[model samples]
Target: MREANHFNERRTAQAAAFLLHRSGGQLPLIKLMKLLYLAERKSLELYGVPITGDKLVSMPNGPVLSKTYDHMNGAAMSEPGGWDSWISDRAEHMVALLDPSMIRTPEQDLLQLSDSDLEMLQSVWIDFGHWDRWQLVKYTHDKLPEWEDPQGSSQAITYEKLFQVFGFGKEQTDALIERISAQAYLAKV
Candidate 1:
């Protein structure tokens, strides 16, 4: 098994900025979460690495990037991290882009996303961006087999489980994880 990786807050902010940019600089919290999850799912399917190395979990709604959700809802007691610098959550629970140029911040390069990753974000937005939060939740629950109904409890959904759904054998999955882990380290270096 591959060692667990820490969450990359920079990448998480980039993903949020991407969604906000596509949604005219503002999005409801639930919709933002859906878009982030979709992009992460696509990244794993295509590149065998997540855009953000955050924990993925099943919530009552759907699959959530656990830490990113916390960051958005202000449940983490954080301030001016990568995400906070670029995004702001209003009283209505909607997140908006505070500074469009924040996407060009120093953390930009640390996001470590390739052109293909950008493609996934744009394509996912194009295809599913119109859906409301509940619709998106229903869609994810129906389409993503790894999503179990948490039924008010949260459940961690590991990469191994995702790889299984993608029909990857143990050896192939392990190798992919190793490669992704190495690439992530190299990017940080």
Candidate 2:
């Protein structure tokens, strides 16, 4: 299992790298904006953070800004002169604001994590999307016990961990939970 996880991580990293290279070392402004939007939305969902109207404003000149931020005050933030830098900064800021403890290396908490807890977390990530969530689950699972029950109630833990990792707020988390529950129920039918 560990080997498989390592392989998956390596593959994911490689895929991300390839994606970067394919885009000439810079994702287009449109793609970056999309990612930013997803990050913000996920953050809001998992962490209970309200998506401020201001956060929706794109960096200046980004595609879709006219439609998304037409009524904003100042110009969109500058594009940082480089795609990687701009995206990285946006991601870091969005994640940090959504869950400061998650992104803050020295302030993280894992004292209550168990093996089953880790598995459930991985499941959540697989259910959600990929990249950040998957990486965070793998990291937590690797460091926690694997002997504990994997079927325990995990609502709070799942919510907290996801908020920590993905910066998703309460509304986002609730919606996701509802969506996942509905999907699971439908699958049984």
Candidate 3:
């Protein structure tokens, strides 16, 4: 995971499920991606860590959760409890929860999500959920300092770069990234 920067599919699934649940169990693919990217950005800003811990990348549309994007596009996941378990296949560029039944109760646990993760999801929703998909894209392109125009290709958006934008110095950013890598390694073990 440290070398590949692979994410916890189960946690990411729950995060996606939580967002889809908030959007009445469905959202356009780009819209859902934008919402998840924004939530991850906000979490990194406020909590000093990303909610899904997925690798971030700047794409043509905007910033994206790379592996999550692959999963959204029906790529085979290497792990169980992946996006397919919680969300439906892309239908007309829209995604819905596979089990709206599980999302019926507001009190029910969204598997692998933490309280802080939920807080960030709600914060992102309150701040930008009502905006249309294009609006969210525009905001990410224009407002977020971490995103670089990939110019027809994608570029990794490092936690170091994001930390710099968040007012962290080089030493601190390097230390934090190293810590995160160590943690990722330990989790894999």
Candidate 4:
């Protein structure tokens, strides 16, 4: 799968909302971020596509959706496709869906994801949503082979390293990354 090579605000918000709604309309910021990262990584591993086209990074806590992290910290609220409308700003290190009740049905929430996309989010919730934020942080940093300790700083986690961990050899990984990148480029045109 290819990275969107950029953040997709609408899809990111929708995914976050879906997760937050499933988690009872609120989640600790770190927990929410870990869930999204796991979901994105799972999507790429399973279908060669990501749920959100956001950059991934290894922070001191764990891996996260880079731009989505920014939004959680109250960035880009006024920008198109941002989470401002769907999610409440972080308060006491937690965030909630702005109108969790508004997500009436699975069909109506289709802001940008397909059935497969929705399914992936649910799967992530089932697998890791129950973990407390600290549990998630430990799992990501200790269990996930892709994340490196960034110490007191952050570092980019590339698809290349993840693919390797997923058992893709160099050539195969390069080709897959190239194809995904071309798709991302064409989508921009």
lDDT for each residue of candidate 4 in 12-108, tens digit (9 for 90 to 100)? 8889889988988999999999999999998888877777778888888889888888889976554564588789878999999998777886558
- Kindly report which residue stretches of model 2 are placed more than 4 angstroms away from their true locations once superposed: 1-24, 50-189
Put down candidate 1 lDDT per residue, 71-174, tens digits, no spaces.
88887654445777677765586889877655554335425455776778888999999989889999889999989999898888888888899999999898
Q: What lDDT score belongs to each candidate, Candidate 1 first? A: 0.80, 0.31, 0.82, 0.83
Q: Kindly report which residue pairs in candidate 4 clash with one another.
A: 1-48
Error (Å) of candidate 1 at residue 29 is 0.4
Per residue, candidate 3 scores C-alpha lDDT tens digits across 103-169 of: 7643466747778888998888888778899998898999998899999999898887788899989
User: What are the TM-scores, per candidate, against the unseen true structure?
Assistant: 0.87, 0.24, 0.92, 0.92
Q: Which is superior by lDDT, 1 or 3?
A: 3
List candidate 1 segments past 4 Å from native.
Answer: 1-4, 77-81, 101-112, 187-189
lDDT of 3 at 164: 83
Candidate 2 residue-wise lDDT, 1-189, digit = tens: 000000111111222222233233444333423333343333334443322111232232221113222212123343322122212333321311112222222113321222333333334334433344334334334532221223442211233343435655667656655654454356347
Which stretches in model 3 have alpha-carbon errors above 4 Å?
1-6, 104-107
